[model samples]
Target: MKKLIMSKTLIFLFVFSFINVFIKFFGGSNTLIGVTVVTAMLMFLERDLTIEPIKNTFKLLGINVFLGVLSFLAVQNIGLGVVANFTALFVVGYLFTYDLKRPMYIAFGLQYLFMVGSPVSANEFPVRLLSLAFGALCIMIPQFLVNKNKLEKSSKKIFISTSEDILTKIRNIKENKNIEEINLKIENNINSLKKMLYDNRKDEFYLNDSAIDILNMGLSLERISLILDNYYDKKMNNNASDLNNKNQEICLDIMESEIKKLKLYIEKEELIEYDINLDEIEDINLCEFYIVLNNIHDYFDEYKKRKNTKSEKLYTGNLQIPSNFKISNIHMRGLSKESIRFSYAIKVALAGAISGFIMDYFNLSEGRWIMFTIFSVIQPYSENCIIKSKKRIQGTLVGGTMIFILFSIIKDPSARGIIIVLAGYLGSYTTDYRDSMIFNTMSAIGSAAMIGSVSILFINRILFVLLGIAIGLVVNKFILPYDIKKGYKYLVDMYERVNLEMIEEINLCIKSKHNNYKMKNLLLVPGLIEDRMSLMGINDKEQKHFIKEQKHLTSSIYNLYVNIATNKIKDNDFNEMLKESNCISECEEVKDVIIDSIKNTEDIGTKVACKNLLQILNSLNNKEQKITV
Candidate 1:
């Protein structure tokens, strides 16, 4: 249950807060307050966006200038301002197609632009742009210091830790020491493995072979834990607290011993040599037992193949990827209604346009805050928007109340300044939406009070933010409305497509007798979709089935890759069988060829790979799980 916010928030507390304090000491105003807040957010976004320094440089300069100009133009004409908001929001939504992190930094830059963009003379335009350039510079510090490599390394480290944690759990099961609680912890660690993997994926659009190894390794760990769960449940009576069967106790003991050895092997530590044969275990269900045994040998198999393995990259297009692009991440797509980015852009742009028009026509106090609120709460899905809006409102309420109480007690400007600084730091350090808003409310009210009359700023902010939330929710529901239901089918289709592509690649690798598993970057597709579906606050049978199928499908594909590609089991015989079966339109013919070869072959690698291919084909549409000896 590690909160992702901890490390990131600590970095924000030290790096960006220092710069904010420096600005405050040198005549900071309301505009600077907005700038500092946006800069803090930008620092977080920057960490997710770029992997290299030069790419960041171009992005920082180009994005700041674009947002700065839009903001300045937004000030001159009301109609143009409405257009500016729409265009900016559209770009944010559309950029989601390119990089997952694009919308974040762009949206933060918009806020900075708006803060220094308005109610000023023409002569102030250059100065405003200059300040934004400085904001980008502030963000660059954290981005360059803590980039994707740090997290990628962190992900690898998690692999070792997950194994150790599972090792502890297995030992607990052996001792029967609060086995239920240990099971819970094991489940939590499995999820942690998933989160850590995707956290790295979300940061980069590129992935190397090592990243792919992490995903496959995680899949193996997940299967190991699940198989253990099933075996222990059947073996140990949880409800009756019944004694372990004396008949099976020895087999379980052997499992525990072997798992410990497996952990040591993954850590590259010396293993205790065993005189006994693993396959000789007298177990009722040798299926799970053999799967675990095979999994233990998997790391070594992959390692042997990886030595001469030419790492492949993602992207099948003619356009050369700018970076080395070594990592696997989400793939790009075309414009369509089903596209998350396309529909999201249209929805956000419409909301931004409406918010901007209201701000201009009514000239409501801090009306721009309404647009900001709309931007913050509105998501690709309206259901998510409602949930986010609720949290945002709760945050604003508590934050406003805190500010009123604290400011009421301390009337001295110097004393309040210290309090305000503390509040801002907490806000910057917060990763939760509700908590951040609570502290952000105090800091916002206190900072505004310093520049203007403190009379009604707190109440005005509370009301305005609420109004914005209400408006955003309504607009999201009525305009280009999308929910998890709409996206679920699309994601399922995408999942199927990616799986099919993997099967195709496996076929090609067998034929060529060379491996080219280049779909690593796009491996994030299933995980990302599953995550979003979970966030929808859904628990229906249909959604649950979808989630289950996704898990099954992805794990099957990874298993297939491990069996066929990672082991490097293919030889001239595999190519010849593949060529002989090429005339058949169906993979069933290929599966038949493989199954026949498996019965005739004594090579362990070839037999295991052929069996796995048969299983994979069986899962797809065939039921040929066995072959006569």
Candidate 2:
């Protein structure tokens, strides 16, 4: 509750600060309009409100200001509007090379082109661009400060709580004599640790090489927890009839006491470190530990099996690419030069057309400025287009509405100043909430207020904005429909890519002396398998067949790897087993026989042969079975 209140307060403060800055620097009635539009755009794009956004916004603002000044000077002899628009477009293209930061750069570029590039007088462009740049800086600085402060607070709490939890869990494991209870507690703790690791690892600042190491450690702990749980459960079941033994009860009491001590240590808010000595547990039953160690060893062996299989998949590199570039391509797919060029061309054409129409309708005289906005801001097809479209529409409607309302309310020139101050407050709140609708509405109201105060007094301005939204929605839905089939294909392709990569990794593991590589590859198998299974619901028959074959091959290889790793058999021993069992040979032979048998119109001959091979492979022990490849 306190955190929520604090967050809201910071938002309001930022909005208030932005409005004040805008009025002080720009003073035009439309200053609020610009703020609202930019704010709405920010909300639409930034879902998580991470620190990266605040930093990126400021960096973009600085770049825009520098470029705007330069362009203004260049166009002093020519026309300021033309130079500003050109500069904005060029900067947008250059800065947008960093994928996530593209939106802000585009937003600034458009703001400059539309708001400043108009009234193409050579004298007015520099002042307008400077005002625009200053307005952006006002909003960006406060946003950055607020976000950075929030991140710092959140990080401190997360780490402290996580560390305490880990220590408490460790102590519980030390105390419990029932073993089953201890194991359960340990498993729970490990799960908690894994979740924390996942959260931290996802955070941009936390994504480092150490993050992967932490994840692996978390997994190892989880494995240990599981082993301990199983061992205790088995022992407790066998000794259930002898529950009244005093010595057993005493040992249990001691374990419970130790767990309490560990909890106390954790709660003390001091780091506790200790070296674990397994040999010191000579007095207590050693059977449980032995069982746990044995299981851990076995788990590692099984992991290697999965790893080897994955490496093989990665080496093959047989993943299929989508046929349709525009509809089917994903961001993960490496873009070809042709595709990039095509995107650039489409963007330029679309922007030119859209801007031309808007200018012709509004009779704003600076129609070319609209082209700058469209070209600079529009994302490529590879980005998540559906989300972007929704955001864009929402921001425009909301900003437009706000501008209209503010203009109507602030009819008197004297009250306009106060209303502008109020608009700033509203902008901050909208930006903080990161809602496209609210931000756009606020921006629209502000812009209308700035543009002739009497314009808002006219009641039909709201209708015009709504009409614009309707048109935009129609364009988005029908003109270039977002295809779900294409999205599914992209997912299928990603699965294939991951699978093929895993196969390659497996091949490397086979040749390498280090077994860790094999284990790492195996860990990736279940995730890929699960992904493929999920994609099956969304994919076509051909994709399903491809996934099925890949799954079968990987699963077979996984079993073979497991047999070799767990039993510690020689390569020759594995080869001999594979030869004797003839699993691979039989599978191939069955395929050939099935094909020939189908041609011959023979009844059950192919089926019988396939069934016989399956039965033999199923019955054969790992030691006796052999693989051909």
Candidate 3:
């Protein structure tokens, strides 16, 4: 909270200071203030103020600064005509290096168009660009510093806590003289470490190489824990207390040896650098095992509940639920089919053009242009977007009224300076809540002041703004509209990609000659599964059903693939087992079931096929017990 407040304060100060400097250098003009306010608001909106790694933030800052300087110099030398197109090309090229090429390219194109047609003069272009750069820097710097400090502090604490926990578990093992207790503690620690590692996946913050290396070390510790558990279990069954003592000592020795090996691996691999080897991650299938274990535990718990108690209603079986449905009175809503047809770029561009045309028709282009610009990117289906738009419109009206009254009271340059300062404060405050009204109000006041300075009537400014918002709202509701289908298609495409990748990995595992090679491939399945599940919540019933069916099939395939990979690793021929157990037939049945589920639109067919596939896969793989829940 302190960090967020500090970051906001720093940004506010930076913008205010930069505006002051600009006003000093070039007498405050309405056009200049309007440009400044717009650019500052854009920077605040675009900047990701979330806690992130210092290195990444610094890297982004350096890149943005370089790009800004390049853009400015390009405009200076090549003129606006050449720089306009080239600036877009450069932003696109930069984005290509980051795998977000498509969206960034579209953004660059729109920004290029906006810059080219903007009323701001060529003489003020450099200053405007610098203002934008300064705004970006303000947000990035404080956020970077605070996040780095917090991560460093947090990493140290987690390390100490984890180490202490491990040591305590070992001490308990030594004192209890009971292997089962020690085994359970070690398992618990492994589970905790697995959760930690999984949580860190795709995280944008905390780039601590040591913390990541320690996680890798935990994988080795897990292996040691498994070995110790096996040893203890064997000794206990044999009733060999003397042997048990020796085995416990042996377990400790083995654990020490493994820890030394892990330490050497970390040192030799230079794992402390944040560049983790994707191949190395493949070797630990801890996440996959964690999911399987968790599911099985849940299944057993439900089974126990069923066995222990009699309910008023007898077990009828699993409740059947369709993934997708449309209900009209229950506030039924879906993506506008028209909106889905166009990408975000097209939607924004169209919205801007339509809104501008409406204002132009009404002879209120200037006020409406601002409204159009704000709503262009605001998604139609989004509640947040609606809220922001309404707030922005109201803000503009209030700000315009304020500017009219203020201009009547204070005609001096110093009063204008104070108004500028107040506008800066309002702008900064808006960034904190993302309240569009405050932002719109600030822009409106700034715009009115700019127009008023040029001898335009204050009443006319207010009327123009109202006219603009009216057109903007009309365009938003009627023009193209927002659609949910696009999102559904996106989810479907992602699902397909994940399945394709899984198939590719499984094929690679099957063909690999080495024993441990397949283990790495097995590890990736869980993360892919997790990604799919996360998308499920955001989808409609039809989409959800499709995802569920895909998940069921994928899970079965993963289990089969794991069993095959394990057998190959142990240098055991599983052909006899495969043939006797009807594995091939079961695989074919599972494939057919999935294909049928995909073809059939009805919920019943899909659910039944999914259940059948799950059952067959479970029956075929005796190593993996069937989940009865």
Clashes of each: 9, 47, 11
lDDT per residue (tens digit) for residues 47-125 in model 1: 4444455666666666666766776677677889888877766765675433222234334534543552244456766
Summarize candidate 2's per-residue lDDT along 190-210 as a digit string, tens digits. 434433332232222232233
State how far residue 623 of model 1 sits from its true place (Å): 8.6
- TM-score of model number 3: 0.47
Candidate 2 runs further than 4 Å off: 18-212, 215-352, 360-362, 365-439, 450-460, 463-467, 477-480, 513-629
In angstroms, the error of model 3 at 427 is 4.3
Model 1 worst lDDT window (10 residues) = 322-331
| TM-scores for all predictions | 0.75, 0.47, 0.47
The CA-based lDDT of model 1 is what?
0.60
Each candidate's lDDT (Cα)? Answer: 0.60, 0.41, 0.42
The regions of model 3 sitting more than 4 angstroms off are 1-5, 18-341, 354-368, 371-377, 380-387, 401-416, 430-434, 450-480, 485-489, 513-629
- lDDT of candidate 1 at residue 354, scale 0 to 100: 82
Compared with the true structure, model 2 gives a TM-score of 0.47
lDDT (10s digit) by residue, model 3, range 395-418? 656665666667667778677767
Order of the predicted models by lDDT, top scorer first: 1, 3, 2
Root mean square deviation (Cα) for candidate 2: 13.6
Residue 549 Cα positional deviation in candidate 3, in Å, after optimal superposition: 9.4
Model 3 C-alpha lDDT versus the unseen true structure:
0.42
